[model samples]
Target: MLKIQDLNAFYGKSHVLRGVNMTVERGEVVSLLGRNGVGRSTLCKAVMGLVAPVGHVEFDGKTISGMAPHDIAHAGIGYVPEDRAIFPGLSVLQNLELGMKKKGQTGEKWTLEKVYEWFPRLKEREHTPAEVLSGGEQQMLSMFRALMGDPQCILVDEPTEGLAPKVVADVAAILQQMAKDGLAVLLVEQKLSIALDIADRIYIMGEGEIVFEGTPEDLRNNPEIRKEWLEV
Candidate 1:
């Protein structure tokens, strides 16, 4: 549902992404894996128009490069940053209600009720401030805030970062459900197992370029790629 080609990005003249290219098919869970210093996050930021890039970013079928971040969000793309951007003082319900996107199809997948179904804890804590949530609840809150947009595609950067194993499993399960609901997911994660669990295809990125692309099994078998991009 999204395609990025020959994209290059920079932060204050320090180029991060170097002619990167990748595609996500409808309903696909595509994972982009890389070491800490690689440009996985940069690529996601560039696609969402949070960072400047020179090249093509197409969503569904139109070019979105150079668009403002708000316009990109309105174009049916949801982004969950590595750092969970929850409003510390806002109630859980209020936070979720903020993600009504302008371009997504009106579907049954991500209504407030539906999000609560996926995360019953959210229902239980409807009035709680975001700062009071545990790490796992905060992660869920961050995701629900974006999902409430009913996005056609989601860019999840490090959904499992800084969470416990059981919490990671919970997050992984939600991502699987999102894929099952036909929303394309482009994930950038450090945990190989978490990415492999839901990703239909994987890309190993380095120095702003995609160095490897394959199925989960293919990645597992390529010891060099695993050692280099993951297994840190």
Candidate 2:
């Protein structure tokens, strides 16, 4: 589980992520939705300690706000950035190997074989260089690589950005399966329909703060909140 309270971040004099508060319980999928420039990615970076944070970020009941990124990761949090961030020259299998918490240590919950079973495309391309894979394949690789670390929770940012509809559906299904398997998932997404379909709860952000917190049904019923904070 993850909890963030009064979380704030800054880029020099410009403040982002103003006093944000949220939680992700185990077996839950919580989506953070907002338009561009609203600090959704900044919140992920702050929680991962890539950005300096001014408030509490607790995971499994201990403070992780100031910890180094690697340390935070070792404490059981995974991050999949908007940019996919795979190693271009490395083989697909090699990139996944690098995700292990310790070199050669495949943790209990996730293994290379299990990942292959989950996504056969990855198995087919196991020996191929990562740079040659399609965008959707690359995205799947990114998520599975994080799973190689055996994290208790994952912070996923924009997982379906440029994929085709089918690929987006695949990604959404994988995220839901992750929640069923008991990993707390914090998804920062641009696709409203995907978020609404898979998330147990939703938090809408505007101007760097959470403006709405409710279930997907509540969000569906609130047209005003959608118009003000979410719609383009």
Instruction: Give the Å error, residue 107, model 1.
Output: 5.1
The prediction achieving the highest TM-score against the true structure is 2
lDDT of 1 by residue, 6-57 (tens): 9999999898999998999877899999899888998989999888978999
| Model 2: how far residue 37 lies from native, Å | 0.9
RMSD value for candidate 2: 0.7
lDDT of each: 0.87, 0.95
* TM-score: model 1 vs. ground truth: 0.95
Against the true structure, candidate 2 reaches a TM-score of: 0.98
Q: List the residue pairs that clash in candidate 1.
A: 1-24
Candidate 1 error regions (>4 Å): 102-107
Give the per-residue lDDT digits (tens) of candidate 2, residues 102-221: 888886888999889989999999999999999999999999999999999999999999999999999999899889889999999999999899999999999999999999999999
